[model samples]
Target: MKSWTLTAKLYVSGLTFLVLALTSIGTTLWVTWNLEGGAAAVNEAGRMRMQTYRLALAASTSGPSGETLALIRSFDASVALLRSGDPSRPLFVPWSEDSRQRFRQIAETWRQLRAQWTADRPTAQDAARDAGRFVALIDGFVAAIEAQMSRSTTLLQGVQLAMMGLAIAGVVAMLYAGYLFVLNPLARLKRGLTSVQRGDLSTRVEVDTLDEFGQLSAGFNEMAQTLQSLYGSLEDKVREKTARLEVKRQRLADLYEASAFLAKAPSLDALARGFAVQVRRIAKADAAAVRWSDEGNQRYLLLAADGLPAALLQSEACLDTGMCLCGQRRAEASIRTIPIVPDPAVSMGNCQRAGFRTLISVPVKLHDRVLGEVDLFFREPVALDDEDRDLLDTLATHLASAMESLRAAALERETAVAQERALLAQELHDSIAQSLAFLKIQVQLLRDAMRREDAAAMNGIIGELEAGVRESYADVRELLVHFRTRTNEEDIEPALRTTLSKFEHQTGMKVRLEIEGHGVPLAPDVQVQVLHIIQEALSNVRKHAGAREVVLRVSRTPHWRFEVRDDGLGFDAAVGHADETHVGLRIMQERAQRIAAVVRVDSSPGRGCAVTLDLPAAAALEPAAPALGALA
Candidate 1:
């Protein structure tokens, strides 16, 4: 039955075969047991014939003797064996009407024979007659037992043949049942599994029975259906993911291009225009506008825009913060989406009148400060998602970084110009200003000498005035050359040679430049400071040292070292340590400090002055990199 599982079906079929096999075995055993008893009974019947002959002999030989008595008792036992079964010996007739009658004849004949043999002196004639009758009865009993045993043998053989037939029939039935219940279903299930393995989700197993395998087939079909349903939508899911990936890839490329362009942009306006173009292309908007706010965050100027009407760009070129949607102050960093609505009451609402329906304003911010904003306008309404908002914000960020960089550079340039002007004023005070003061004093002396009419004093005063004029002229030329010169970062030898040659030509003094062990060259800024210090030493030599010959010694390793020695009228180092008297010594010390170098002056009242510059070994290993041309 369909309700019966495989276990129940097999159990019932197996039980039927077991019952038949047991019945056959039990029937054969029963027949064999009956034949065993009949065989024993037949054997005892045959032994009674021998006892009959022995008894006749005993009767004729001696009457009432011990031997004759024993023969008689033996005969009695044989009869008793046929009458009652010897269970231990298994000696019994197969009880039937013919077997019982035959057994009774054997017992009656034996009793008569025993009585005749036991006579007081029995004659041979009587004994022979009794033995013959007794022997006939024993033969009849054995024949009946043989017939019953033959019947038992035939019945046992029949039971064996019936069992064999039952076994053959059972085999045929089980083969059919197994094929119907197990093999056929399994073969179908296997085919279905193969199809599924080959990627056919449509393959299904048909369930014809409510067995375990049938439940398995039903479950398999359900699984295949689910797979088919899921696979139907798999292509759409893949396409969706691929489209999203494309958007992300495009976003990355745009960000990379914008960052590179902004990083190296020459000016703020240039950076803003380039970034605005990039945003317009990426967002596919109608018009893009970029603005930069002043430091006060109060007023902002429209820096650049890619696609905007000339009229609109001019009108919105400059606006105050909080005036329009694009220029509104921001509390948090986020993209603002505005729907432009034309309203006559609104004073600064020019977007809707310009045929723009949507306005997306993204603020350009650096960390916490809002620098400005970028506005995108669309004639048709536009929808912006989180990704679109993030992209606009990132573009704004790049713009902010570029603007900050340009502003910082401008400020640096102005600061440098102011510092150089201050240096010039100091140079004038140290050289030209002091020289004119000397000229004024000498003119005063010359007038006094002329009033006195003393020839000797007038001649001396004129000569002194002539020398002062030459010194003033020389000081002006040296000051001009010092401020105009530039330093080379790669090597200092060329600049040193040029400075020494100029010093020799201007002072009309023999100059010797001695260079020592060299290593990696000094940076341009360091070279600038070193050159300034060296020139200051030369100025001191020309003004006061009165040296005819000068030696500039330079050493680069194991540390940077320099010495400016002059064979002039040297002053006391202790007394002339004042910056005003030593001619820009304080300026030289300041320049030395900038490069981490030490400047020491060695001199006596008669000996020449030598300015020594020493840079420590540790500082010379790796030069610092704060702009090579940033010395000013």
Candidate 2:
């Protein structure tokens, strides 16, 4: 055969696919044309049926013998024509044994009817009337022809559907073949090239076929092999240098991991304990200890010790600054090494002739203040290199940072708590304290009126005290709700509704809470702020607005928006945000700022007021903020 290249193979496969497609369509068309003959056959059979009925009627009635004979001859010709089948008309019964036998019986019955009627024309009424059976036989033969034609039609439809299926199958087969011959090989080559690009020198592509793609794969394997050999020889030349670099890399990795572990230690003791272990491992020392010193650097306390001799650790558990190598004064000594000699006279000053051969102490300091010191003791004599000293210095710096981080976190909590307390105190002074002062003044007035024996004035003072007491009780509950605001991100609606209900109940004002649109709820912290702002708006409505109804609408349109509307005597919202004379509006603004939200008030003096909080789109997807307990 000629060279069987990929193009030739594709050409042959495509040509075969086309031939199969055309053959299927040609078969369908031929079957369709052949079916036309069946239609004509059905027509002739129906005419034979009508002629049989007419001939019987002519013989049964007093018709002329000539007409009766003529009808009989016509029916006989019809039956003979059907028996002789017409290939030119393309009409033929699918003559199964049953149909052939049925036709014979039909022909025989017609002959008997013709013979009986002709034998005695005047008295042949019964025989001629019996022609009904012969006509039924003819009907059976016509039905057989129709059943065959119907089968032919079904076959044609099947051929059409099969052609469609073959077309689809051809496409799928071509695609699958292309994948095997082209896409799969290309993909393999691409992956090999990518691996080589990523520094994989030993990557090789498989060469299975002798096509162009296979040749390409073969070339790729050769290139990779060459590169691998070249790189391997170059690597051998610099093996020592590379080993040193790898050691440094591993050293840096260890320092980073240890620092991460120390940073997340949660407590100072945990930080010290892990730090001691890490230092001993990285320094390759036998024993290690961590000590904390006072700010004055006058005394040191053992915070954590690892692999230390029990007797030595117990004896040197606490020490004054400059007592030993580990507790040296900050100015006189930095990170220093000391040789441990077997000195019997130095009982407590030295290790008392323990197994330690050398001691390397580094200060865990932040700036000039020495927060702690890490002591490394080795059983074997070890020489210190500059890199080893630098490693120790980095580990010490990380320990210092970890300590400071813990202190800063503690300070932050204390600050939030202090802020919360201040806010509580201020809210109390504004609400309940003022209301109590008013009630006290009313009580004094009532006492004076009673002493003077004035009934009307005493009654007025008592009513005033009652109203003041109710107002003060309501204010205390509102403050409790405000300070206790806690919720999950999904419970924004529930929290807002709770606030609205409380406002409605405390102040005999009708509240309408409506939720519209749809979206994921805001972050938990954002929801907390939103709930608080809504509560503040409702509180303003209750205190200042003299209207009847309040409507709080919460909606999410890409971003979250909350609106609190009231029907009370609206204050000039332009007069700063809903009576800015009070600290409530200021608190609302601060809360909005924390979660990247905006607060606005729309109102006129005679009309109602509406306070809307619009949170930006990006803020909704944010994770919940750290729980800063209701500072509002």
Instruction: List the candidates' TM-scores in order.
Output: 0.74, 0.51
lDDT of 2 by residue, 169-232 (tens): 9999899879977899899999999999999988998877777777788899999999998888
lDDT of each: 0.82, 0.79
For residue 60, what is the lDDT in candidate 1?
83
Top-lDDT structure, candidate number: 1
Q: Once model 1 is optimally superposed onto the true structure by TM-score, how far is the C-alpha of residue 548 displaced, in angstroms?
A: 6.4
TM-score: which candidate is best?
1
Which segments of candidate 1 are over 4 A away from where they belong?
1-240, 294-301, 309-324, 342-348, 443-466, 484-488, 491-523, 541-558, 565-571, 577-581, 604-609, 617-629
Please list the Cα RMSD from the true structure of every candidate, rounded to 1 decimal place. Answer: 5.5, 30.7
